[model samples]
Target: MKELKAFLKSKDVSKSEIFKALKISYDEGLILQYLCQLFFGSIPNISILNLLQGLFKDKEEFSYLDHLKDIRHLMELGLVKTGYSMLQDQNKESLFSLLHMDISLSEYFLQFLENKKPLDLSINVAYENHLEYLKDEFERIKLYTRLSFNPQNLDFKKDIQAYEAHIKKRLAKSKFYNVLAEIFKENKLSKKEQIIFIALLKEEYSLKNEESSSRELNSLLALVSENELEKLKNRALLDENSKLIEKNLIDYDEFSNHFYLSESILQRIVNFKRLDKDKQLRLENALKDQEIFELIEPNTDINDVIMPAKTKELLENILKQQDKKVLERLSLWGIKNSKEVEAKIIFYGPAGTGKTMSALSMAKSMKKVVLSFDCSKILSKWVGESEQNVRKIFDTYKEIAQNCKQSPILLLNEADQFLSTRVESGASADKMHNQMQNIFLEQIEKFSGVIIATTNFLESLDSAFSRRFEYKIEFKKPNFKERFLIWQKALPKNAEFSEDFKLDDLAQYELSGAQIFMVVKNTALKVAVSKDGIFSMQDFRESIEKELSSSFDKSKIVGF
Candidate 1:
């Protein structure tokens, strides 16, 4: 009673506020005094209705107090016994019977007490259902007080410790612990639950003897495999200050030079601590091999391409030999061993030839995804940054490959300018060029993935750089037969052409397959756009002239 009086008299609270909070009737101040006395140790003789009326007079203003009133009413109705006698008796069945009756009365009283606080009936039901198992009198008191006032201030650590204590107390008196042990032996827990349970067991038990401790530890460790144990240990070691370099030393500067992404983006990705469990799982799945090949675009097969028959046969044999060698090397190391094969192909040819198409065709034939690297996009004007960006791109590709469980085809388009062997004459531009080229060569040689590089001016490329590729395919201008087929493929299926539409005669103009296709497309567009649905020879001639004129003008501007 003195403690309650002191609490009520605190500067932060007032008697009027307590009266409003408890929703007590003006006449029932004496009843409140009696309750305070009983709480602090005093006996009282008052009708349960008088106590309920005092606590629930203005249920709308102080509905939380109504639950305490219901408890008292249930006691009066003989649905429950006052004090902790029922809990201490261990008569769970009898306790449950009384609880059921109390619950029904509580519900009726709650309905009668209209405009009350929004109480969670489910929580109340759960508490009632588990009341028999709640053995910690201190915890029960703390929980009740918190729920009655500020539930938000409830301490999880205190609750968990109290729950553990309750379990321990029950295990000391019953066969519950032995039953739990049998259940654990018969069933496997999920990885997350296993970790938590193992941690809990470790905290609860401390073996006095070394052998017994070892046995217990071994039993806990048996829940996970050796590899999983190592993984758990590794993960445990990765705290906030953990660095990537600690596990595996990477040449960050060299890596940066090869990938064109910004250091900030790379750092953000590398240092990203997965906060969400689902997101972490997603990241883990992405790291698997299934998603790797999807990052690359589909490439065309070079073998099916039409060219000079001799050249085609010679190149096909070379590619076949290279493929065999790659397989042999891979087999020597072991199948599914990605470390042995150095997958690089070089395609050299004049401008307007099929070098790029050949690389695409090769990828298509192999049924592999191809990713074209735009050197211009990776190369930066800022000093040192270009190499870093290039490295990042390669690293990204490598990560994609690791996740997808497949090697991606890296199509380094326009390989001549950067890969050229020309030495710098101590000029800044040449120095930059040399640095970038060296980084590219180093990365390509070390890369386990497939690479296809195309060069228009083979002579201009450094011989040293040219030697690195396993196969060199030359793309020549399409011959007459090939040219005729190109025209057939390019033209729309429904278009009607006269006998004078001779592709062999058109081949005499020395037009590339792309140029021929462009001409056909332009001529078709003109015919379609015209008011009359007619294909005219004049339209074809005009399209050809227009293309030729543009090419001639561009060549003159370059002083070719």
Candidate 2:
């Protein structure tokens, strides 16, 4: 009630002017009735409109009947109600229909009603009822309305006093715009740039304001040169750094190149700035690795890896198909020998089944750098924020892929958290699960570059997600012959072979190649630590027994 009163008194026009305008026509009776229910201590009905028209006759410029025609339709439908009972029966379709109407009209009515003064309990109750009826509509309307009304062009003389008062009352809770102001101050943005930045920030973050919020955004249309603004707008659509770039505030490319990052790495740097400090540090460390930094260069070939013959053949076939698809897409798009060709793949399997080794081997065989997607670092804790982070990652990948002339491979590890099956439960967890799954699906379908997603539990993923992937390679546990080779390859050159600890015997344990490697390493460590220079068959056997006991204990799963 206080907020509404403060809003109305701050306006230049008085209650009589609003009433005169609302009561212009016989048809406008319903609008006047609603307004009376909002401003005076009366229920909304046909009689209030008559009283309003009689009270505002001095305002000659106002007309009520003309606007009443619109309100009459609602009356005819019996949609108007005096209390919260109206909202109890509302359906989604009905709410959506009202929202699709002229949102500006809704805003006008809301603003008009908000300007009135005095403590009118009956009117306040009706206003609350109207708000309930239009809650969903208002949410959608506010999104676009706030976007349309840029706060940068506020008139100090006409708006400052009112805006300051409104700000203190309504927008005192938001700190996002304040944070943006700090960023602007720290960065020393130009006045024009600062205004544009604020508008963009409010649109992106959805801030609330008073006089400042009502400022015309059209002024920003002339602030920057057309070409520069378009570039900035497009970049902003991709990541936050685009805003800085649009203002010519910072050169991201130069900064990235100076740090010797690949195009993907550079884009990551821009995206990383939006993340929390711990995540930024993780990405920084990943970028510093020499193997990852060299990914910008083009890959030569990928057939040299000494993997199982079947695995190699399957990968080669998929790679060939991917190459053809890239050429076809390029031709259709009328691009000649384009360097930005993306091929995505998924590798799903049990732990120690060679997913990581295969990815690294593919990169090594092709003489290309493999860029892994750090899932743990990118998934945000804030609601609706994780999807944005994921989008930023993909956008950066695309930018880098396009710039480097080498299609970068994005390896998404432990992707089940994002690609989980959608459920119909009304729990908060379910909503987040659905949102993440939808975002991931959308990104995967639209992404043109190479992406490799790995997961241990493929069944946990949505069926729709599994279908989008071009290939799904299941790295099953190796057979005896494969295990024998793994053991032979993993063993040190100086190690002695004995009958009881033979490779063929060890292969029968059904252990993965990685497990075998660990077993051998641990056996050697035990021999060295015990001051026994000679590593014996008995020592290896004991180590294997100990490993089996410990592994069983770790693998035990209690029922939830």
Best of the candidates, lDDT: 2
Clashes of 1: 27
Deviation (Å) of 69 in candidate 2:
99
Candidate 2: tens digits of C-alpha lDDT, residues 124-169: 1222222232232233233223322222333322343343343333
Candidate 1 C-alpha lDDT tens digits along 1-560: 33346533444323544444343344343344435444345343333444555546766754534455445433322222332221122323343233223121111112222232332222211222122332233233323322222223335235544554654555455522232233233233344233323332222233223222111222223222233334345432222222322211111223212112123323432343323566546545544533222234444455556677776675565345334345555578775453223457777776666776666666655545666676556557787876776676687676555533236678888867766776859887677777877787788778775687888777787776777887777877666678777777777889766546655555555567777778988899888877775666567677877887787323211110
RMSD of each: 24.2, 25.0
Off by over 4 Å in 1: 1-296, 318-342, 403-405, 552-560
The TM-score that candidate 1 achieves is 0.44
Residue 453's C-alpha lDDT in candidate 2?
80
The TM-score between candidate 2 and the true structure equals 0.42
Cα lDDT for residue 489, candidate 2: 77
